[model samples]
Structures are given as C-alpha cells and as structure tokens.
Target: MKLSIERAALLRAVARAQSVVERRNTIPILANVLIEAEGDEIKFRATDLDIEVVDNAPAKVERAGSSTVNAVTFHEIVRKLPDGALVSLTDDGASGRLNVEAGRSSFALATLPRQDFPVMATSEYDSTFTAPAPVLRRLFDKSKFAISTEETRYYLNGVYMHVADAEGRQVLRCVATDGHRLARIDAELPEGAEGMPGVIVPRKAVGELRKLLEDDEMKIEVSVSETKIRFATPEITLTSKVIDGTFPDYSRVIPQGNSRKLEVDASDFARAVDRVATVSSERSRAVKMQLDEDRLILSVNAPDAGNAEEELVVAYADEKLEIGFNAKYLLEIASQVDRENAVFLFNSSGDPTLMREGDDTSAVYVVMPMRV
Candidate 1:
C-alpha cells in the first residue's frame, strides 16, 4: 500500500488516533491503528477492545491496500516532518514492515494483519432521536464534574440520561448523584423521543461523546438499545455498551421543603468559599458558614494549620443559622450557577439543602449537610 498526504493533514489525523492509544499494551495490535488506502482516501482505525474510532481523510491514494503500524511511533515521526513536505507511506503486501518517507526523514514500523482488529458489534436500536449540540453539551458538561470516581457503586460513576417531567413539561433530563451531591438538568425533548428508554450512559462514553458535540448548532443523531447506545454526527458514529446496572432512584434525595433562604452573588460566594478553604487540610474540608440578618461569614479552622475567615453581604433575612459543608462540594455546586446570584434553601443544620439558579427550576442541585 502507498499514499501521499500533506504533513499537516497527516499529523492532525495521527494525533487524534494516537491520543486514544494507551501507554501499556498486553495485546500487540491493540497499540496500532490500521491504515488503508483506496480510491482518493485513506482510513485510520484504532481500538482498545471496547471502543474503536476510525478517521477517513482525503489523500493521494496509490497501490490501494492496507497495513497496521504502531500508532505512537508513526505519529511521533510524522510530527517531526518539515512543514509543507509531502509524506509517503508504503508497505509491500508481505514485507511485514511499513516504511514512512518525507523529504529527508525515514522510519520503518513493524506491521500486523489488518484483519485482526476487533470491531464493536452492531445492534438493533430501540430508539433514535436528535438533539442540538449545545443541548447535549449542557446535559453532560454541567453534571460530569460531579460524577463519582468510586468503583464499588459502579452505577454512580456516570450521569444518568433519561426522559422525565419537569415543571409540567416533558423534558430530556440528566441526573448524577454521589449520595452526597446531585445535579439535575432539564432540556426540551426532541421529536420522536417520547418513548426513549432511560439509559445510564457510562462515564467514558460521556467523555467521548463530548468531543462530537462541540459545535453549538450541530444536530446530533442518537440511537439507544437495551445494552448499547450510539451517538453520531455526519462524519462520526460512536457506539458503546451501557453499564448493566440500575440507576438509583434519585428523586427521593432531592430536598423539597427547605424554608431558610439565602441569596448571594454566585461569584462572591464561590470566592469566599475558596478563600476561606485555604486553611483547610485535605481530609477535613468542612467550611463553617454563619448567617445573620444580612451578613454571611465563611470560616475554616484546621488545628494543624492556621485559620481563615471571609465575609459576604447576602440577602438572607431568616433566623440565624450555622452550617458546615465540604469546601470542594460547595465550590463545585456554586460554579454551576450561571447567573449573578445563587439561591440556597436550608431546612436545619442536619438536612440536605437545595440550590438553584436564581429561581430557575430547569437546573437545580442538592447537597447533604455536614457536621462542623
């Protein structure tokens, strides 16, 4: 097989393909991306057994055939090639090695059988729908930061995507909970999605799917089944196995009747939470919040370290309240508020509190309180 591709075009495709290749490999071909040339195009495919990605780019195809090469080594070689130079990749049908050539640079990669690469199985999808890129972006972007890293629960390690009624309107919803904090987001449902099954899209799929949804105006075609889910654009189709576990019933954890209300500027509150947390040790990140008529005092005290305190003017006029929360959790939830003020609802010193974006129900959050 032989093909000539410009250095920039070759490097962009190889960089994307190699980033998916892991550093350690027990299987030889798992570290390679199969390259094939036919017509005027060349295709590059890479996989780690569970996930596979293929990129097809226009090239000067010659000799029309396929070969496998090390993804990292080939990418490193192409990256060093001089700008505007023409790169030619060639391998005899049975040489067992692929030769790369530029103006004055040369390298050979050991080739493997292209037929040995594993591809994901295709399935009959139970549902298909389309959503705007930004709609899907907000669904995952706002909630992914709260995804649990704990492997024991496995189910909580991903954002739960499903259809639910929000404020008397049918909306596509995403919910993620780590038992201590939860993010619930609602977006308008697309057509033909009324019967979509609730699927717990895994963490890695959520990340891979994010790259395809960057264009704010692009419409994404999504397919779902009992065991697998697929997301596609005109140029890319991604299919992955869904986690085979039931997502916990998250609605019961959402607080409803918290009466004490505190309204403060979101940026001011986040800065105060961060500034006071400087004195906290890793294990104990509890930040004590003292609320009076219209003043909020944020303080942190660690015996081994020093102490920190900051004050913020808020709109709280309820009875005096003192509460403690994990500094990290507070900072995360506060960053979700896009508006100027973040409204927090409290019940008592020991109850889960509710947070929302300035009276908007579309995006709401809940956090369990911690003892100081």
Candidate 2:
C-alpha cells in the first residue's frame, strides 16, 4: 500500500481508530489497525472483537493495497509530526514492515497480515432511522452519568434506548440507573423509528458515540437489530454488539405520588452540597437537608471531622421535611438541570426523591436517600 495524506487528516483518523484498540491484547492481530488505501481515499479500521470503528480520509493513492500496523504507535508518530506536512505510508508485502515518512522524521513499524484481523460480521437491521445530531446528543449525554459501574448486574451497566409512550404520543426515551440514582430523558420520536426494538447500549459504546454527535448540523443514521446497534455518519461508522440480557422494569422505580414541592436554584444547591460534603467521611459523604416553609438548610455532621452547614432561601410551601442523600449523587443529579430552578418532589425522609428542571417533564431524575 502506498499513499500520501495530510498530517491533520491522518491524525484525526488514527486518533479515533486507536481509541477502539484495547491496550492489553491476548491475540496479536487485535492490537493493530487495518489500513486500506484505494480510490483516492484511505480507510482505517480497528476493533476490539466486540466493537469496531471505521474512519475514512481523503488521500492521494499511488498503489491501491492494504496493510496492518500497530494502532497506538502509528497514532503517536503522526501526532508528533509538524502541522501541514504530508505523510506517506508504504508497504512492500515482503519485509513485514510498514514505512512511515514525514519531512525529516522516518519510522518503520512491524506489520501483521490483514487476514488475521477479525472484522465484525454485518447484520440485517430490523429498523433504520435518521435523527438530528443535537437530538441524539441530548438523549445520551444527560442519562449516561447514571450508568452502573458494577459488573455483576450486567443488564444495568448500559443506557436503555427504546420507544416509550409519553402521555399519548410515542417518544424515544433513554434511561440509566445504578440502584442509587436514575436518569430518564425523552425526545420526539423520529420517522420510521416506531418499530425499533429496545436495546441496551453498553457504556464503552456510548462514550464512542459521543464523538460523532459533536456536529450540530449533521444527521446521524442509526440501525438497530436484536443483538447489534450501529451509528454512522459521513466520515465515520461505529458498530457494536448490544448487551445480551434483559433490562429490569424501571417504571415502578420512578415515584409518581410525591406531594411536597421545593424549588431552589440548581447551581446554588449543588455548590452548598459540595461545600458541606468536604467535612463528611469519604466512605459515606452524606448531606442532610432540612426543609421548612420557604427555607432550606443543608448540613453535614461528622463526629470525628467537625461539621459544616449552609442556608439557602427557596420556594417551599408544603409542610416540613428532612432528607439525607449522598453528596456525589446530589451533585450529579443537579448538574442535569439546565434551567435556573430545580424542582424537588419529596415523599418522606426514606422514600426516593424526584427532581426535574422547573416543571419540565422531558428529563427527570430520581435519587435514593442515605441515612446521615
């Protein structure tokens, strides 16, 4: 394979491709990226057996061929080259090496046979639809924070994407929970998406999808099947296998009858919780919230490490209520609120608390209380 590509274009493609390659590899070829140069463009493909990413970049192709090289080493070499320099890659298929040259710097990396790389098999998608980048971004960004890190409950380690009935109309919804807190976000369902089967997108795949959603004006093509989900754009395509388990019923976890209401500035509430949590124990960073008529006080009491408290004037007309919650959970839930005021609906000191952005039902959060 012989091709010349600009440094900027080559760096962008290799950076994304290397991210999909796992650092520790039991199979030798799994750590390398397959490079194919043909038809005035070069394609970089990398996979970790479960997830695969292909990136295309325009280049000047002299001989149409393919080769495989270390993904991390290739990326680092291209990243250190001077801007605007032209990079050339050549493989003779005899020396077992891929030559990389840019200006005064030259490096030869060991190459593996392209036939050894495992490419993910294609699937017949059950449903395919297009949605705006911003719409898809909002659905995943707000809910991914609540994804579980525990490995035993593999079903809860991803965000659930499916069509849900909100009121009377069908909408696209994404929900994530970790047994401590939950995030549910909804968007208007796009055309041809009504028949799509619900799938649990793994946490690693969700992080990779965020890179494709940065363009505000671009539209993303999404394809879903029983076991795989694919997101594609003009320059990049990401394919991954979905979690092979059933997601638990989450509707019952969201409280519906919380009556007491308290409205407070989201930024102020988050900051006060952060400040008071400094004195609490690292194991259980609990902050107690004491709510009265038109007033809210946040306090943290640690017998060994002293105590801290902060008072904030809020809008609460209901009866008195006191609740305790983990400070980290409170901060994450409050940050999801984009609006000025965050509305909190409390059932009691023990029941789960519901929070939303100033009466907006599109995005809701639930956090379980902790005993102080």
The estimated TM-scores of all candidates read: 0.94, 0.99
TM-score for predicted model 1 compared with the true structure: 0.94
117-190 in candidate 1: lDDT tens per residue?
77677889888999999999998888887788899999888888888998788999999888889999999999
For this target, which candidate reaches the highest TM-score against the unseen true structure? 2
Candidate 2 whole-model C-alpha lDDT, 0 to 1: 0.95
Q: Show where candidate 1 strays beyond 4 Å.
A: none
Worst lDDT 10-window in candidate 2:
278-287
Task: Choose the strongest candidate by lDDT.
Answer: 2
Candidate 1 local distance difference test against the native: 0.86
Candidate 2 lDDT, 92-187, residue by residue in tens: 899999999999999999999989988999999999999999999999999999999999999988999999999999999999999999999999
lDDT accuracy of residue 328 in candidate 1: 92
Each prediction's total of clashing residue pairs, residues at least 3 apart in sequence or on different chains, is 0, 0
